[model samples]
Target: MNNYFNSNSVYIEEDFRCRFRMRRYVFERLLHDVQQVNPYFRQKLDRAGRPGFSPHQKVTVALRMMAYGSPADSMDETHGMSESTCLDTLQQFCDTIFQVHKDEYLRKPNQEDLNRLIRKAEDRGFPGMIGSLDCMHWDWKNCPNGWQGGFSGRSRKPTVVLEAVASYDTWIWHAFFGVLGSQNDITVLGRLPFFNNLMEGKAPQLHYYIKNRQYNMGYYLADDIYPKWATLVQAIPNPRNDTEKLFTLH
Candidate 1:
């Protein structure tokens, strides 16, 4: 632990980032937050009155397991913990992080957020654009044999789909995960609840004008696979003229 975290540590910040998949300050902040909320991370004494694992050890083990996909038992020689204990620590760390940070980090956009996103999009030449919508597949390396057929798609591997809408700063305003990988972007959209509020007239209203053409609802920049809905703006697949080329470029 002292090798990277101590004041006179041997490794540099870059080395720490390479090992932890995050900067030292980020890890330290996360550690502080986790320690604040979860008492399980606090060090205690064993039955023989010997000092137990420190919060540092537990957090480091959890991070190593997550960032490197290291097995629970993989830390035995380094951290001197059992596989089951490592698994428990990892689960607790994840739950605590989510519980503590979910509100600010993972929340639906309010009116202010929508307005900011709209302003940014308008400055980029898209008057009513909110963000970009897309789907990606994440491999399920430990997928069950019985569920592999349902999860495997064109990639011929067990996977799940994640649909998200992200803006210029890469802030994900919307995320819908765990869709069958066999599904395409369109199919995933059909099942997404992202539009449910809009359909029910419960979503925030948006108004914008482009060259005297006014629009009431905000839209997303999607790919050609998505349907030609007013709320989605797709680029021209084959631009024929300068005007078309300019539209596609931006």
Candidate 2:
């Protein structure tokens, strides 16, 4: 692990700095919004027990840990903190930051936002693309004892699942995380909040908007693995015949 860390240090540090800077911006935005909508964080900070590390330091350390995937000991050396302090600060930061930001980060996009995205897609060649849906897997170090069953299967290793939606230019619109690794892409997609809204009438306007603008019928692009949903457009089949090859090329 140290060898991996040493070899990758330069690249890791550069990437970590970029993400740390971005996260500071995101955290500040979250802080302002929390003040307006909730006021809970401000109140808690004002009434806290004997103060721990500065919130900004805690947050910076946590973001660096996440972005670099470095162990706490390594983070300590890199950030010039004691190992125990690095570990404790990261744990606290994860707890505090999520508590402050989860609502804003995880909440589904509003109808207006979805409509704007759809319109933007229409402006590009791909019309009615609400977003491009995909799944990504993150390798887990070890399966937790009791939770092993939930996190292991054919892969036989712990993993976390993520589902993301991107625009035509591949800008991620949203990301969902923490589904157990054993689950397949279809299972994860089935459980997504956005998919549920589409099933219910909650996202009806966006559905209707896509239909009106694009194929008259609703459609979205996704990989071959997804079953045909009314709102999803699957890739063309692998080209086996000359006609299929021609179609695929176009």
Give every collision pair in model 1: none
How far off is residue 44 in model 2, in Å? 18
TM per model?
A: 0.85, 0.62
Report the C-alpha lDDT of model 2 over 116-215, residue by residue, as the tens digit: 7777877765555677777777776765688867866567766788888776656565777746533667878777766775455333344434435534
What residue runs in model 1 are displaced by over 4 Å at the alpha carbon? 180-182, 197-203
lDDT of 1 by residue, 206-240 (tens): 98898898778887899899877777779999999
Error of 1 at 35 (Å): 1.2
Give RMSD to native, each candidate: 2.7, 7.4
Best by lDDT: 1
| Clashes in predicted model 1 | 0
Worst 10 residues of 1 by lDDT: 196-205
Q: Name the runs in model 2 displaced over 4 angstroms.
A: 1-58, 95-104, 145-149, 168-175, 178-182, 197-203, 207-220, 239-250
